[model samples]
Target chain A: MSDSPSARASRTTGTVRIVGAGLLGASIGHALRRQDVDVVLADVSPSQLRLAIDYGAGRDARDDDRPGLVVVAVPPDVTADVVQAELEAHPEAVVTDVASVKLEPFTELRRRGVDLTRYIGSHPLAGRERGGAISARADLFIGRPWVVCRDEETRAADLAVVEALALDLGAMPLEMTPQEHDRSVALTSHVPQVVASLLAARLASAEPGSLSLAGQGVRDTTRIAASAPELWVQILSANAGPVVEVLDALASDLREVSDALREPDAPGARRTIADAIRQGNEGVSLLPGKHGQNRRFEQLIVMVDDTPGQLGRLFGELGELGVNVEDLRLEHSPGAQFGLADISVAPDALRGAVEGLEARGWRIAGNTND
Target chain B: MSDSPSARASRTTGTVRIVGAGLLGASIGHALRRQDVDVVLADVSPSQLRLAIDYGAGRDARDDDRPGLVVVAVPPDVTADVVQAELEAHPEAVVTDVASVKLEPFTELRRRGVDLTRYIGSHPLAGRERGGAISARADLFIGRPWVVCRDEETRAADLAVVEALALDLGAMPLEMTPQEHDRSVALTSHVPQVVASLLAARLASAEPGSLSLAGQGVRDTTRIAASAPELWVQILSANAGPVVEVLDALASDLREVSDALREPDAPGARRTIADAIRQGNEGVSLLPGKHGQNRRFEQLIVMVDDTPGQLGRLFGELGELGVNVEDLRLEHSPGAQFGLADISVAPDALRGAVEGLEARGWRIAGNTND
Candidate 1:
């Protein structure tokens, strides 16, 4: 169901060199290599480079390799330095870096007096909670937003190369200024991380018994808090300005909520609390549904035995019923022998889907549409 | 693998009366009726009572009926009032109320000088984001912690009845004082709800493009913010003290984080930021895994096509390989034709599980143990 490597390789000719053989770097190499593109992997850490190569990410980079494009995928702190080095080493190459924060490195490079025309900054809003080449996948960027930060000085050809890189990896390329990219991520990513961490941190001193009552709600809220601190420190610090702005606004909101709750019977206190929560409902509603579409699908909950192949038979039956599943979520009671499969389908198809599954001896626990 | 209803009914033989047939009330009726126990459901709303009865929750309650157990399943505000009325109406029956906020209702009843010996307060730590009788399930309490708050004046026989109800519904019964139950839920449930709402509320006034970059991190952090504001307003207000305390601590933490980010190069700023995030990791690590076990399992990622029966085939092969899955999570790339199934197994079984699955033509993406 994916485009063939030969077909992709025919569109862009010449070697693509990737610096920093970490998760993003190796993942890009893997995706490009699958398309039969010549990808040269380079890194300061010899072991990481070798591991990435062994995992079929790319071939080892050599001194004489004159690549058409150079992807700088390194730590945020060193990204500017590496981008500068990559450009200086391969003057003819269109250089792009897949860093989380765009403005910081762009500013740093500009301050260092690096030639700006050949450099195009891009960020693929894609990654697993874990990091490193070992956890990297060739399809990591598939269908995710890959933001390209272009300036007036950026050459059209150079910008085209980065956009094509996103396209070749099956990611949607979005154009934004560096400032817009940083500010946007601060709200969507950085602030959420801080909020989650702060919420989870409260449990540090909580009683053991209290933690036992933790349900999926708190678990989901704090799931990303398990992320490595050192990596987050770097990401957070690099985008500190934008992130701090977001945090300040959130802090003010928190203060108002705390004040309202402290004096619950006061005038407008209930309104304040309810409005804050209602705002949250409005905020979350803006999020696009599956495949980045705004259309809402009805959810049907079907109980499946925890045994093997139960879900398989259920999905097979759904297929036979001609139901196209938009999304699927599986949840299990901690000690129960069965789990609930929340399958989302078109609203019109919900009745037929439920009837068909029920006919197949699958118990429909409940549905959202009802 | 579940015990038949007849077996459960034989152990506790008596009519169980449920008051206020909402989610918890109706769910209790559904579960008890399945065990062939006589269940009488009463509610203020005639239509809701009729709906519950039609859904096989229970039959209508009658004045002539004598109940062995009277379960008060009303809203928090009316819980104490209903409990008092139920006790007055059924003087011989043991009365237990399934209120999320245990302390408020318990105190309210006690303040009115109600008979304390017959009243036991309990909370089942189970619910969907949605509410009402339509969303109720027989297995809602299955494998969940049902906190039974026993006071010093409570009779052993009355306590036993509440515990028995939890057991009959396939829940794990936990004993805690009313104060302990309220504080515990404030940390595990209420605070998380507020934090999620606060985080999501930030997105309300955000730039349209900023929200488009939202990923799974923000999504999970704010998922529960979509919960009904009116319902949560009641829950939060009823237990305002403990919830306010949790929110205050979080507000202080947020302030510190904002300050730290404001001066990223300060002497202790980085340390403070990293420490807060690290504390989050510690807090989450304390959360018990499946079946209330703290032991960590190895996770193996397997790539499966987004088609019917693919997961079934995979699980069947795992079963054939004698692999017991401890937990499972599925993630899909938007617009991708495949999904990654992260299967957790016991550490000692990780090697065998991976090898077995790979041998059966499964593509193992990676494993935590690797």
Candidate 2:
């Protein structure tokens, strides 16, 4: 989980004026500061602004310099106006806004006759459900993906500056068109949050005392529901249309599943259930792989008893084997036997992990290739 | 995480017949075997039958001894047929099941005119996604929930016996009607799996290059998608209507969110998105506080830098505080500064945990009681 600091600083051709002293703003400032680049941090709330300053994200605006770059990190609704205002105050600063959805802000800026040659859009894929400058950290962007979007009019130099900033913050630059970014996130991120919340919402209406028995599956699936409301609104509103498309497809699948269950004994009923499962299977396969597919991990399924010390011993064995576990997932179906732990190890090391477990007389299911 | 075992052996009224020597069957046999109670294990697969014996879930069929209890732990599609056979073969034995969905098996047995006095629909809220006797665990149900549905024909003594069995297995007994159990699980369990898989399937089609940047959120959200397909089909089919209903509602919310994003400035769009987040917040509240609503400890949300060694120090301070953590959930969100950690402690020890963090100048959020 540790990412080394960026040893070589890319000399910035422009200074980025980061307005908004919240998590994103502070992080941007922190990243720039670490690279020893000049940055001016501004915020409406004096307390928040002071916090950013105290945290060393940036110094005061009167730092004897005009910013060549401006990154606006604020709420979704206020983002565009902030960008234009920053642009109006400094006509030369190549400006970009860090917001979840791009199309709306891009249109708003274009409508106001902003300098398209200097402007671009970006959103760094690094955050917690928690918010505020209080939650800001310097390495927030380390090894994270920061998405950058540019249209035809944008200057190549401006794009490079943004890319440099992303790299300076320890984030990998991901290039995509505005529409592509919005749609992909709609399927990948936005829709999933809504689904998680809706699913968790049902627990409130569950018959009395039913939830007390809830296990890890419900806990994991509903984890995102605890996310802050204002933040989600910013995300859901920005990518609403694309998200709706995915939901509509899911609705169609659900309807068919419903009809199929009503008459399970009817002709083709078995196929109906099977089809729903297959559709779900197909749908889940579209997600990005681990570290955006840079790491290929094999799923090692080990059947573990419900006894104490079993998991510890199994993990100890793996540790002894020196199997570098990339990830671990536990499945607790509703009333079966031992839990199956699907561990992700380096693709090449999986055979060893499995062989080690097998030699220790552990019953393994499925090959690592699975 | 440890619970004391039952100090005294449970006095069994008679032998228990467990049909289907797969994971669940073998588990129940192991649990009861530890209690020194008689159990008979049966299954369609001779290999599975042998594994159950090898695992010591039960003795051979000749030891059936006219069981006083019969448990069905097979496929959902065949539950009713097998339960009917068990009922016909041993009319004196009380019947129960450890299947995912209850209504189907209950109705199936009733439709076949099986005796109701000895029949009580029960579902143990413990499991692994894996199947087969090789995966069986004796204490699978320990400290979990065991839901039992009782009818007028269900003998009070038999219900008590089942409850006693649940307690002996270290599970808390919960009461539910057949319909409620089916509907609740359909929403909370089966639908989430489908939804998670549906989400994961989308990742499979992701540009291999783009997929590399995938992070923990995507991985956690899509975790359940890796579950076995056939088992889920049986579960979804058995509780189709309610599962479909939940999915339908989710789809509606998804459509609304999507439409809002397409034209975010449109009337009522922002409120719609906000409502979805608020609904999710409320849903999160309904989940059992730490430890299935039995908060054995207090919760402390610590705000830490995104830098390395920060978290290790935070945990080290907790260890120095002389308080052990029960569980932890970490996230790397998209577009945020710092990660907020919610750590739980006993109610009385809450202040100490807070003091320990604050003494070290860690900004902590949220109170256990509040």
TM-score of each: 0.95, 0.84
Task: Give the best candidate by DockQ.
Answer: 1
Identify the CAPRI category of the predicted complex in candidate 1.
medium
| Candidate 2 docking class | acceptable
Q: What is the two-chain DockQ of model 1?
A: 0.59
lDDT of each: 0.84, 0.72
* Tens digits of per-residue lDDT for model 1, A300-357: 9887777655655676678778786666666766666777787888899999998888
Residue lDDT tens for model 2, B151-186: 777778889878877777767778888888877787
Tens digits of per-residue lDDT for model 2, A1-370: 2333447755565566789989889877877787778778899999999988988898888846689888899987898889888778887787888898888788888898877677788988777555677767676676677889988887788898888888777777888888888776776677678777776666666777666666676777777777787788777766666777776766666566667767767899778777556655664555444343334557777766544345546766776687754555554423333455666677788888888889998757454442
lDDT of 2: 0.72
Model 1: how far residue B146 lies from native, Å: 1.1
C-alpha displacement of A145 in model 1, angstroms? 1.6
Candidate 1 lDDT over B103-147, as tens digits, reads 999888879988778889999988776677877788778778899
